[model samples]
Target: MHLKDIIWMGGLLTVLSFPVSATEIEWPVYGGDNLHQRHSKLTQITKNNVSGLVEAWEFDTGINATFQATPVVQDGVMYVSLPFNDVVALDAASGKQLWRYEHDLDEDYPICCGPANRGVAVSNGMVFTGTIDARLIALDAKTGEKRWDNRVVGDNTGIREEVSRLDDSELGSVSGTSGAGINMAPMIYQDTVIIGITGVGYGLHLDATDSDSPLGAVVGIAGKYGRRGFMAGYDMKTGKQKWQFDTIKSKNWEGDFVTKTADGVELPRDIAKERASLEKYSDAWRYGGASAWSTPVIDPYTGILHFGTGNPSPQMEGSSRPGDNLYSSSLLALDANSGDYRWHYQQVPHDSWGYDVASPPVLFEITIKGKPIPAIGQAGKTGWFYVHDRRNGKFLYKSEAFVPQKNMFELPTSEGTIIYPGVMGGANWSPVSVDARRRLVFIAAIHWPVEYKLHQQPARNGEAAIRYSSMSPLNTPEKHGLLTAIDLDNGEIVWQVKTENPLIGGVLSTASGLVFTGEGRGELMAFDADSGEKRWSGKTEAGVNAPPITYSINGKQHIAVAVGGNRLFGFKTGQKIKVWRLP
Candidate 1:
């Protein structure tokens, strides 16, 4: 096998030179491996036998909340994180609980979205998880006992006060106020466990009036409301800070004011006005919001970490922050060892449309123009799967819009501008799966259109007038979901499937030529990877609003996923991890 076929399992480089037995197959990372491919090599559950899969076991976390964890398995133990950041060790074969570590959150700790932890990272006999209170914790892999706890950030006084002062009436009916927290699964690179902070790109998320409906709106009030976000590395054993990379650049944030994207998509910008007001908000980067929304994929050969950044702060209204936001709404590459900036590809410059590059990036080798190149792909909220040269961040090509996109990059007007793949995203924090051998990328995406409206309120209570913007899904279009497979070689949709509701979680691809993903209606469905044929479907008690992972224990293959629904999208919430296998 070639060097490109080597897989990094929990920071150790292992070459896939020969076929390993099914018993040795285990999901050791959030995306199945360090490449974040989310592909399993075990073939016991082939397409022919997938329809016969039956429930093998189910484990309830007992804390019903928005569960989005992707369980990691190694040896015979499955390590999973709960909605409240609690860690649990389970017997992978029977879903039997071995040990549990309850996370003790600070009573006054600030939370943005509900307690939704993506998952945990296990390395060197320790399980690492980032808490909703901005703390990094390490637990013994054997007994689930605490090893070390490090606070990623100490001061949240400013953000807490700002959130407290937010007027609900002015912001509409919000479900939660944005505050700093850590929700992403930590990534282990060598001896350092990497994680990032979220909610720094503060925006008030409105709640849907109907309990079963999707989100209502995301309101962005114009002011200094958030602090800069960062992704840092810490020692896995001691939880000591190694280095930090700020998402927003303090200086030279205003890049070349390009009127269009690299692909020639025109942007609506007041370049003249922005240049004139540049000096006024000169210190804007201090509070600039570009929250790290997902786990990064590292190029083991190059030692470069690739990840995405969220929308700029004060969210939708960007008048106060001038020029192209350097790092926000972009794909960034940094040195994994030193945390030094390598390159960045900004998808939306000075973005006011809330088009965050929120999806976790996937790395693979692609042949471009007869030359094999190390490439990285990120499914963007802008509705395009962006492919770039992973080594130097070169724009290669982007897949056709998987979801319907109308009036993209349009600035909000007082009357309201309608846009598909709005704040909720074309591909939110969901991770994509890649079948390197087939050159296909599977993505779970949303097709909900939202109305972007600008609001200007009159001066009241001795305060000055306030201007803001809001995004809410439009009822007329009717929200839905799309599971798309894009050919990496040609950047075209190979196959696509539609679902009744928006797909929020992630995707799993298997060597059995099967693709698995969940729906908001609580069904785990599998599809033929080559053709968009629905092969099988399994119903769950709650919405399967998390990624599915496949592993083999005792030579028996099993598929598992966290079954708690997402609160932001108003999916039916529960507390269960369901596993299935061919009986």
Candidate 2:
């Protein structure tokens, strides 16, 4: 792929609009654009020629952490953020480093999840990113020089360090150990950059019977540990906060305490018991853990920024804090300009199980009942693709379960209850791709079931009162990844592919009738977008746990992905970015 063929002859230093140009393609945002579609119009590498794709170039960032950043390309320059918030700019056509920005973080920063960064956002003349220290920073796009840095969280004192030390250092010891950190790519809208925090609601994870195998179990210990999660918009020029929207609503946090979901799915919630304790736990929303783990997608016409929220605080045990846990485990729509709440559709209310809406919400138009309507769709951890009216947050039809569903919404028992699509989810943090022309949404899912067991006895160390759940993965033979193609017109799954390992990364679809995704087993495969037939597969040194993106340099299309496997999930880890093109 040479840069001269499709490169629009323009000033080399010109700061162009997001799309870059008419002939040259650019992946300018986290989701390629504000719609979060993860789709490209380039078709030079079509299905017929996809098998001939060969390695174009590869860049090693030299740091080997859980790499999940999706490189953003624009005007022959590609920007990628490595784990630990290090930003690197590279030439899109060749594997050459342009500049690098090294971020310095405090040693004592609180972090609960794996050290992974999503990517970086480039706008005007600056590159923006959020860090593991809960800070937002912007750098000069040309030289990779720091422009401005601002802290996202106000105070870290809210972290529970005192209460955690008590209880014989077991029941509440997890608090203050790790809290809020920024792991997602920032979104640029107008003059504001949008970002959010994650890991605040995270609990201790227990190793399986064998550390070398896949995760055996997870446990969400109860405590007032993390702070309330939020998403905010900041002034791009000054890095000053413009507006903020808390995921947990302070006033109406309880809402109507509905026992069923908006789609009429009966949630196993004790409404009367929750209401009886409402007053005592009314202020729990202040410390509620509804982390915003995905980037926000904006509707250019309506100015609504949509994203999903994580699980509520003290995950898996809703005894102390109850009443629907408003907004957590929900699809939230907010006014992009003012950060005002618009509407929310909760996926799991008073969620005792960790069913976070971790997938990025995709925006598109769907025809329902012979009527076209603006809509947003999200592949949920609950094993379904949920569709909703983008204008009013109304429930549109949902696709059939892409993965196997067994004992869904069933409460954890003392004897250990099995839940399909467990904590790893039907769709975890992996992003989905949409093909508007084909009317199909490509989703990467996991079929791992977890054994959820509630523990009512005191800690073995005779710690404070203990009541929580031990979520262990059933490392049996049936665990695998499900790559599904769902037709939006009739909510039917057209084709599904199963993999030996769970699909934790993201997906990309194109006009070339191809779908691309990475597997936990270190393979990058391209499938026929229409028939779900495997067209080509290449092995990277590490697992490709990040999303795949396509862009054009000299009329030759190229596919790029970061091959840093996930350590938490036992996927091999490395620090490599591989780009492929037609030979």
Candidate 3:
């Protein structure tokens, strides 16, 4: 009964007006609200009964590999989060573990993406998480007990964090690697949780200055005594740090660009990488492309705080630095109480194909030519679906619909807009659903043209060396992965449903017309949000890449998922969370 006394008695019964219950069973966070739009206006589980459903329970976290989080639930309880940073709490109708905190991780942090944790941020009774060994714990949401552990990026930062600390025969440097952290799922926003660090900077960029990416941040801790990251506030009741935002724009650029050292000699920076302990304090911390990695859409009706930025690294190339790099892959619109900015919408301006707008923008409200406005519609991977105007970022379109585009600047007009659903567009990171009472919105896509193969590796005693670029072989074939259907009054797309193993998981629509999803092939189906047909299926022995939730509990109505392991196969079904319900 304490989520601030249930939001102060649901805002005092909506100001003595009563109403407001709207089906009470919660899915709580991740994309259920804070406007992530993995929408769910509760439809009593539809598609004419989702094929009579089944399963109702399955748990086995036998410690597999990459279980992309997303379980959350509350009141009835269920928290999940495992991949290396482990965190457990279950009882949402009998899964029973009730508390398991496992966190010792030290195989030598290399992580491009593996020990991924993504799920757990409950607040009030506690239950926070973020650690690939980078730290940010917080438990006890009913006795998981630990209450605080904020390390927030600390393997040591100063004396080169003690010379990258690796004694004992240099301990093979970080053997088998388990070392890096945070894969997503941390947005409390009021007691200040914020998080956003999925990599890139761990190698540093303005030619990588050193220490393991201090230039790729978004921090903001403070739940109850553990002060961390850039530090600012939280002394209130004692979570520590009250304010801080670092971005000092520094550069190295490996002498603007020129390398040839496999044996030749042109050394500049990344001698062998890992440097960035929050150095530049000013040029706004410009080291290279931004890295906010999805999950940020606050808008309690515009107290405004949106997010989505990435791919400005050496991963792909916009030649080098160039303009339009402001705030990195752009979409920011801060002021969530001083993170400032307020209005940006670049969606791949100089982007280069590591396509940044990492997905999950969803904020809702439709209408275009007739202008109903109030939008925030994202769906990117640089393949495009943009939609802006979340109170003033406007792009309701006079043009802005891109694909296979190429204006390369120098334009009096068309400089960028060709975006044929390239980097897994229409949706990626699985999560797109909005019923708004059946006005409809349900995404799922992946159409190919991955393209991006830059490469650079020779900055020896000075800096800049570990470039990391390779991706352009996702030929999913069969027309590639769509689920489309747009027309929230006129942006037009209206009917799509083309799949062949390319939906990328996370979607659930109801009002009883059904549209559940989770299938990169581990099945878990049901369609027909209005003629997409197909109606029922189930498999999930693995690969559905998380994101699918629906509830009811005592009255029945299930349908959940999280088949585990992602970043394209990591956790391997061994980490499970599967539900179905109907009987």
Say which candidate scores most in TM-score: 1
TM-score of each: 0.94, 0.92, 0.31
What does candidate 2's lDDT look like per residue over 1-583, in tens digits? Answer: 3222433456454333444353238798899866889988877988888889899999999998788999999778999999888999999999899999998975676656667889889999999999988889999999999999998886762355243322222223222344788888999889999999987676555432322234545566655656678999999999899999989888878888887877788888888898898888777787788999988899989999999999988777787777888889999999999999899999988887789999999999998778999999999999999999999999888899999988988888888888897788999999999999899999999998888887654556656666667677777889999999999877899999999998999999987799999997898999999999999998899998999999988878899999989886779989999999997
TM-score of 3: 0.31
lDDT of each: 0.86, 0.84, 0.55
Candidate 3 steric clashes? 49
Q: What would you estimate as the lDDT of candidate 3?
A: 0.55
- Runs of candidate 2 with Cα error greater than 4 angstroms are 1-24, 161-176, 207-216, 459-465
Which number leads on lDDT? 1
Alpha carbon deviation, residue 493, candidate 1 (Å): 0.7
lDDT of 2: 0.84
